[model samples]
Target: MIGSGPGGALTAWSLAKDGHSVTLIEAGPRLRRPDFGQSIGHMLASYFWDGGARTSRGNVVFPTMQVRALGGGTVFNSAICMRPLESALERWRDEHGLTEMTSEMLDPHFDAVETFLNIKAADDDILGRRNELFREACSELGWEWEHIKRFEEGCVGSGECITGCRAGAKNSLDKRGVAEVVQAGGRVYTSVHIDQLIVEHGRVRGAVGMTVDPETYERRHPVRIHAGCTIVSAGAIGTPTILRRSGLTRPAVGSALRFHPSCYIIGVFDEEVNPWFGATQGIHATEHLEKGIKLEALWATASTFSRTLPKRPKQFKRYLKRWPNMAVWDGWVSGDASVGDVRVLPGGRPDIRWQMGDADLRRLQETNALLCEMYAAVGAKEVFTGIVGLPDVMDPREAADRLREGRFERTEMPTASNHVFGGSPMGTDEERAVCDGWGQVYGIDDLYICDTGLYPSSPGVNPQLTAMALAHRLGQELPERY
Candidate 1:
């Protein structure tokens, strides 16, 4: 395993339990409870790639977040466990030639994963004002909404899922799957960076790289590992870059990248929300999912929140004063229309290029409009649209109208995507996809990809659950095949 996020950790655990000798290598440290920071700035520097400042280049400079840790994004995400939508699986089957990628084939694995991770819906008791307000708005609008299902066992509702769960309630892979892998006699190496694969006679032998100090990031001892079979679960960006650096120059190696292209709006109300005290993201609406939109309640620390504020110091300060009475609601477009690619730069850095298609941008505009309506339904006094051309603050109806009717370009919107997919997609056509139906690299022997990078198209929902399901299925087959 070349990475130890959800895919990596879960796969490694499965292999280890099956009595396979597993070696899990992680680029980031095995952060303990104390190491998980409270503030967003501290957590980003510690857990995220590029201190959470990494962005794609092209038509729009959109931000992307990737985690670098033993448990990967499972440690930092809100633990939203959404099954792959049947419609998306159908698309994969019809358009991508992934005939077996259906709910019937994958639901058992999803069930096992949910059972192991203790995934369940968040209780109403912990759905603080922010989440409650979202639920109320959804009810008022008669849109279908539900409590977010999560891997929280003893959650205290600190609303710190993005930073890290300090209460030890979150079932992050580092605390669960990775730990089980170790107990089952798997070897785990932390802070090890794999530059490229060791290809011998057109087959992967293993990988080569160096270990670095977790905090200083100073290069340390040279490291190399030889394995009978190598699985790269290094996330959507990391996996493709490693494949490219290894001289796997097939066109499909880093092609067809995709994202959820998400943004959030703030609703300032008259009552105190204390947004930072509840489950990080506890309620979500899927009414517009057919249109590629998913809405949810969002919260972050004050410092992170301040970054989304207006540039005008006066207006910024004014918003800061209303923090206690504000709630953040966010939405994401499936990004089926958008496309991107990852290329390895001279020094092994990833150069990501992407462009948001006009169709997806319009979907985002509709998403913003829906969010405005939701806030308005709940009687928000004012809203911050965060679109460049729109006023920083406006009445809910005016914001909704501007969002619905405005002639907006992709560049005018501030969007980011925590959920990214593609690059080393799995498909029947070797000419288009880097991996095959079983996640085996098309032309490479004993090498596989088990990550979001293997997704041929958007899964149309939060992807962690589906990513794990794929990895779990791959794990079951690899031991038998190899």
Candidate 2:
């Protein structure tokens, strides 16, 4: 297993439970509770890829927030657990020929993950003031909203879910699944890079890479491990880079990249919302999802909020002054029309090239309209659209008019995405996909990809639960062959 995110960790846990010997190799260092603190700077340095600085470009430039820790994204994500919507599964079946990835077939896997992770809906007791405002706005706007479920145990609403929770609340893979794997006799190698798979006689025998200390940047020694079967869960970016570097050059191996491109909306009310008090995010709406759009509250922290603020010192300081009154919401549209490719740079790093297609752009505008309306509906006295051409709206009626007339340009808004799906897709069609219905890579014996990269299209929602479910289904089924 070449990763430790939900897909990789869950697969490892399952395989180990089946009495299989597993060696989980992670390129990043392991940080436990002792190494963690409240500093966002330390969190980024210790957990995130490029210290949370990597960005992608094409039609629009945006930060791609991938993690580089023992547990990968499970370490820094908000722990939002959502099963794949049935509508998205239908698209995967009809368009991508993923016939068996139906909701009914994967129900057991989802149930297993939810039970293991202790997933539960956020209750009113923990929903914080920010959520109260958001829920009220959704109600007033006549949009159906729901409390988001999270993988948590003793959660105290620390509001630091994004930067690695030290409260021992969020059930990140490192604390849950990965720990179980270790308990089941699986070995883990952290801070060791896997350069490429060793293919011999059309079969994966092992992999080779060097051990480098993440703290000192010192190359220690080259290492190799031989395994009976190989699975790549290095995520959408890392997996493709590894395959291409190892000479797997099928077109689908690095194509069909998709994302739920997103922006934020901040509204200021007379009373202090103290937006940083409770759970990072516990509320969201799927009312407009058929249009490939969704809205949720952001996991706002001081460091993240400052980063999303205006570039200008004066304009930025102004927002800081009003920070107490500010309540932020997030919006995203599944980039259905926006297909992209991940290319291996000369140094083995992945370069993602993507631009929002017309559909995605329109979706963004529609999201802006909905978000602006929500803020207006909530009796916000001042609303900041986070848009360049648009000014602060003081009147709800004017906000609606401007939203309708607004011509959204890519340059005007800041965007960030944690959900990057697809690079090597899996399906029954051998020619267009790199992996089969079983997630086995074509022409590569004993090697498979078990991650969201296997997704032929974006699921348009939080994908961790879906990825875990699919990985569990395949992991349990594939061991019989081994």
Candidate 3:
């Protein structure tokens, strides 16, 4: 295993359960459940890359927030355990030549993940005030919303998922998949960052990297590992960076980077909604998921909330005063944008650059407007958006007008994408895709990428199940090692 995120962890578990010798290597340190604390910012500061992380585009740095802990990104996610949207799967087939990613092909794998991860629909009894309001608003507006399935138990509805779950109830790989992998006789190396792949003549032989202490940030010792077959599960960002550095010259190595670009809407309730009270279960408007829009409710801790405020401190302070009553609605665009690239910097570091086109911008505006309507229809006092210098939309028409004007500078536009994918896509065409349908990298013998990087296109939903399903499928394809 080349990385210990969800895909790597699951793949390691699968292989180890198959009675194979497996070593799971993770770039970051193992985040303990006790380390999950009150200060969300402090936790994020330690577990996130580059100080909660950022991406760059021609000197413009866009924050790319991904978890650098043992569980990986799931540690900081909203715990929305959605299966691959059927429409999204179709789009992948038509647009990206992913013919084999059909529902039938993915059913058994999904079942396995659901069983192992303990996925269950959030019971209505535990829905927080905001989630209830959201449901009420959806009912009032006739907007379709689904009760999201989540991998959580004993959720006290404290909604600190974006921070870290203190109750240790979240379904992050650390708690579930990786835990099973370890018990199933898998060796997991924490704080071991694999910098480069040992590739020779189009075959992955081994990897060389160092283990660093998360607190001291000191290199522990130089280490090298030999594997019969190496799998890259360093996520879309880290995986592509390694493949490029290893001399895989496929054009799509760093192309078609699809992201579900998200914008958040804030509403102040008459009574305390306490947005940070539930499991942060993502109840999305599935009706619009394939149409390039999704509306879901979420919240943040104090620091992340501060980032959402207007640059003016006075306005921010004014909003902070009403923090108790504030609830957030997030709009994610399944934007018609392909990924750019994660270029290797001179210092052996990685830098990612992406640009959204007119269609994406339009879709963003449309989705935000829709969310505002949903909130406003249910008697929200006002709706504040992430767009800077734009007036808070009290009326639906004003919101539509703001979206119609398409002169947004990339700097003004937020460019953070939690869902990163397609650095090494699977396809039949070697020139267009990196891996084959079996996830074996083309032109490379016994080298496979069974992570989200193998996604030919963004599924516009949570990619966790999809990645796991792919890994399970790959495990079935592997021959017995004897």
- For every model shown, the clashing-pair count is 0, 0, 3
Model 2 Cα RMSD, 1 decimal:
1.7
- On lDDT, the stronger of 1 and 3 is 1
Per-residue alpha-carbon lDDT of model 2 for 1-482, expressed as tens digits?
Answer: 99999889999987887777889998888877767777888777656777778787787887788888788898888899888778888988998788887778899999988998899998777778888888888999889899999999887887787767878788898888889889999999998888899989899987888897877545688999898888999998889888998888888888888888887877778888888877888899879877789899876665666655566888788878778787888898888888788888888778888777887877787787788788888888766666777764445446656877877777776677889888888877878888986789998899988888888887768878888987788779877897
TM-score of 1: 0.98
Q: Ten-residue segment with the worst summed lDDT in candidate 2?
A: 391-400
TM-score of each: 0.98, 0.96, 0.94
TM-score comparison, 2 vs 3, better candidate: 2
lDDT of 1 by residue, 2-56 (tens): 9998889988987898888999999999988888777777888777899889999
lDDT tens per residue, model 3, 110-226: 888788888888777667877887777788888788888887877777778877888888888888888887888888888887878898877789888888987766778898988
Candidate maximizing TM-score: 1
Each prediction's Cα lDDT score?
A: 0.90, 0.82, 0.75
Q: For residue 364, what is the lDDT in candidate 1?
A: 90
- The reply for model 1, stretches above 4 Å from the true place, is none
**Candidate 2, position 468, lDDT:** 92
Q: Any runs in candidate 3 off by more than 4 Å, and if so which?
A: 58-61, 310-315, 392-411, 480-482
